[model samples]
Target: MKKVKKIIWLIGLIYVFCAMVNGDAVISSITTEAETTPIEDSASYLPDKEGKENKITDPNNMGDSKKEHLDSEISSGHIISQETLNKIYEQNGEKVAYLTFDDGPAPGVTPEILDILNREEIKATFFPIGENVKKYSDITKRIYEEGHDIGNHTYCHIYKEIYSSPESLINSLKKSDEILQAVLGERYHFNVMRFPGGSFGDKLAPFRKAVNEAGYSYIDWNCITGDGEVISAPTDRLIETLKKTSQGKEKLVILMHDSATKATTAEALPDIIQYLKDEGYSFKPLSQIEEGY
Candidate 1:
C-alpha cells in the first residue's frame, strides 16, 4: 500500500512539473510547488514615488500611478468639464464619443471592421500592435487614408516583458514605431499611442514621461467593451457589458480589441455602433495634443 501511494504521488508530481514546463498554469492559482520555481517572467518591478522596485500590488487599480491631467496643448488649460459632455456636437463640438480599437489590424476581423466603418461614414481610432502593423500593411494605410485615426499599442502585448523595465517599454514602442514608420513612411504621424495594459501598469508615470518627451500623447481608456475579457461571451453579452459599464458616462471613451482572430470584438461592433447611434452617441477620432509631448 505504501509503495502504491508513493507511485501515485510521483505521477502527480510529474504532471505538475510538465504543466510548469509548458507554461500553462493560471497565474492566480499558483501553488507552493509553483512558487518553488518563480514564473519565468516576474511581475513588472516599477519604482513608485519613493523609488522602490517592489510595491504593493493593487489588483483593483487600473494601473494609473498618477491621476489623469489636462494636456498642456489646451493653452486655455481648461480641463473638459463633465457638463461639457452632456451636449453633443457634429462637425464641430458635438457630444464627445470616442470609439477606439486596440491591438488590431487582424487579417479578417480588421478588414471587415474597416469596411463597416467606411459604410457608416464615420472615422474611429485604431491602436495597432506591432506584429499586426507589419503583417497587415494595407489596413494601416486604409485606416489613415479613410480618415480614421491610427494609434500605437506597442510592438507586443506581453505585460511583464514590456513593463519589466522602463527601457523595455520604450524598446517595445520603438519596435512598433519602426514598423509603422517604415510602412507608412516618416510623415505618417502617429502621435497618439496606448500602453498595452493601459496607464494602470506600475510604470505608467515613468513610461508616459518617456513617450511624452518623444513627442506623443499617452491615451488611457476610461471605458472598455469587455470583448477582451472573455472569449465565450456572446455578442449580446458583449453589448450588454459595454452598455452597463457606460451607463452614466457622458463622453465615453470606449476601449475595444481588434487584433486577435478569436477575440470576437468585430462581431459585437455593428450592434454596438447601432445601439450607440440610436442612443444619440457620435463617434470621433482621438486628436493628438502637444501637452504631453
Candidate 2:
C-alpha cells in the first residue's frame, strides 16, 4: 500500500513539472511577438521626402547614385563648396592626384583622351560642354561606361550667356541636364562643374547665392598646364608647365580646355599622362572634398 502511494506521488509531481515548463514557453513566445510587432510599425516612418522626391527609377540604377543632381551627387564629385580641406593620411600615405578636363568631349581630342585613359586603366574627370557633348554623345556614353566621372561644364559653354544672371546659371545647368538625359537616359546626370575661367571673375556674382542654394559646386583651377594660353605649345612645354604647377601640392586640379577647334592641347595630352603616371599619382573625379583655387 505504501509503494502504491509513493508511485502515485511521483506521477503527480511529473505532471506538475511538465505543465510548468509548457506555461513558461507560452509566456516567452508571447513576449517575443510583443517586442517584434512595434519594430515593424516604426519602420514605416523611416523614408523621408527626399527619398521619395528624388527616387530615380532604373532597375540597373535604382540605388546607384552615380550621376544624380548637384545636391545628390556632390559627395561623389569630390568637390567641397562648404568645407575648406580634407586630410587623409595613413602611416605611409601616398600622393593623390585629381585629373580634371574642362570644356571637352571635342571631336578628335576627347575620343583620344578616352582611348588613352581606357588603355592605361586610369579614370579622370571631364567637365564637358553641353553643345560639344551633343556632337559626341557616344564619347559621353563611353565616359560613363568606362567608369569615369562627367561633370556639367554648362550647356552653352558660353561664359557671357551662362553667367548673365542667377536664373541663367540654373537654366544653363537644367538645359545641360536635359540634353544629357536625352543622350544617356537618366544615368548621366552630372551636376559637378567647373566655372568658365574658374572663380577668377565674379561673372557668377549675380547667381552667387543661388548657385549655393541650388547646390552646384563651382570648381576653379589651382594648377594650370597653360595649354590654353600658348598657341601651338609643344608637348615638352605642356609637360613642363604641368610639372611646375603640380609641384608642392598633393591635391592638384589641372585646368585643360578641349572645346576650341584650334586647341593644340590634344598633341600634348599623351606625354602629360605618361609623366603624371611616372610620378605615382592616382586619378579621381572632382568630388566635394577637394582643395580650392
Give the TM-score of each candidate: 0.64, 0.65
Query: Over the stretch 4-113, how does candidate 2's per-residue lDDT look in tens digits?
Result: 99999999999999999999999999999978854332122223466554332333333445234423632322335533422322113555666778777877778777
Off by over 4 Å in 2: 1-93, 201-203, 260-263, 287-293
Q: Which candidate leads in lDDT?
A: 1
**Poorest 10 consecutive residues of model 1 by lDDT?**
69-78
Whole-structure CA lDDT of model 1: 0.71
TM-score of 1: 0.64
Report clashes for each candidate as comma-separated counts: 8, 9
Q: After superposition, how far is residue 235 of candidate 1 from its true place, in Å?
A: 0.2
